[model samples]
Target: MTIADKGPRTRPFEANWLARIGWLLLALYVVYAGAQLGFSWQRFSDGLGQGGKFIARMFPPNFTRWELLMSGIVESLQIAVLSTVVGIVISLPVGLLAARNLMPAWVTWPARGFIALCRSFHPIIVAILFVKAVGFGALAGILALIIASIGFISKLFAEAIEEISLKQVEAVRATGAGFTHILIMGVQPQVLPRFIGFAAYQLDSNLRNSTMVGIVGGGGIGATLFTAYQRFDYDFVLAMLIVIVAMIMVAEIVTGWARKVFQ
Candidate 1:
């Protein structure tokens, strides 16, 4: 019953030397990048002073042009709702086709490729292109947001479908169900709740992007905000920011409630 009688003790924890080295390298690179980008305490302090002055100018938000503000807000809301509806409808088939578990390789590959193409560009870049193509209006904004929604929701929906329980799917197939019927009874039930959540989240995103697309002449509050900036109307800018924040908060609440109801 001496020490020699005991089996070799296992170490409670072991250091991962490779991971430690990798993290050290990452930290060093961050410092090097910061220096290259001219990030310094002195520069940051000077920025704070300029930012303070800018904030001072934005005091007493001007809602004097309520008509313009109301119009821009309405347009942004329209863009968000329309884009969400169109995008979700399109994502249904594209996402189902892209799910490797559900569709053949021929179908999934092309569907995934299309999704990747949609996601390749930022929404702002897409909006700018649409603006150029369509010549400055809500149509450009709606199209751009729709593309963004398709990219996001479809990818997530495909992933959700892939993760569903195959047991239910097999059971449906055993019942002599065809592909369409199997999807309706087996696949749809499993993924519909998640799909609803994704749709709600995409609506929130579209709302934010709708405001921004107008900066590129896609037509929304962003156009008005950009005009105010150009005219040094900081008060109006503040007012617009307040409204945008309020809109986002409301959307968050609505989406959260929808998620609960569906779940």
Candidate 2:
């Protein structure tokens, strides 16, 4: 048969010239952004020299302020734990109500709105607001982190509930179980592990954020770190950094252990 007679035979896709041009335009935009951000070789070389000087000044980190550091760490721990507990307690009902399949529109809409409001701002900004509202210190930080945790976990929890096996739920209902009973027996079992995972993750994040909220006078290690920065005490700053890193690592390990135990 002649090639022309074969007509439109299927063939491998060839790269369109338009697509190639689009990629070329994207590359040009990246280069433009780099230039706008002052990402030049000369600027990088200068930054390295300044960084080396900063590093030299940070050597032999002073730990003479051990008492202050310990106090701040303890306060941060309290804030984190308090926020996690409060957030988890509040999230359970809100999450259940936000699950569309499980709740009427009147309930779901308000629950979703509450979640959105909680998530509307960064934790630091929320902490600042709380500090203004309720006065500063660990209380403000705890309240802020609690709001953030509720926003995060509740939304995820609702999604987890929505994705659960409907067949199991149907079977429970068929056994003449009421809505509450079905939820307790069929729905809770399916999503409990994931809910635990989310709670642990929120606790870990709250620990890290509790430290940062102190920078804004909400109370924690961050306040001391900010004071050290104001005094140009880079050695103390380095010491604080080391301790913060250790705390985060320990939190991560503890969270992992909890997840494993619960699983």
Scored by TM-score, the top model is: 1
- Write one digit per residue (lDDT tens) for candidate 2, span 1-263: 89889888766787699999999999999999999987999989999999999999898898999999989999999999999999999999999999998899999999999999999999999999999999989999999999999999999999999999999999999999998899899999999989989999998999999989999989999999999989999999999889988999999999999888878
RMSD list, candidates in order: 2.5, 2.9
Question: How far is 109's C-alpha from truth in model 2 (Å)?
Answer: 1.9
Per-candidate TM vs. native?
0.91, 0.90
lDDT of each structure?
0.95, 0.94
In model 1, the Cα lDDT at residue 80 comes to: 97
User: Candidate 1 has what TM-score?
Assistant: 0.91
Native-referenced Cα lDDT, model 1: 0.95
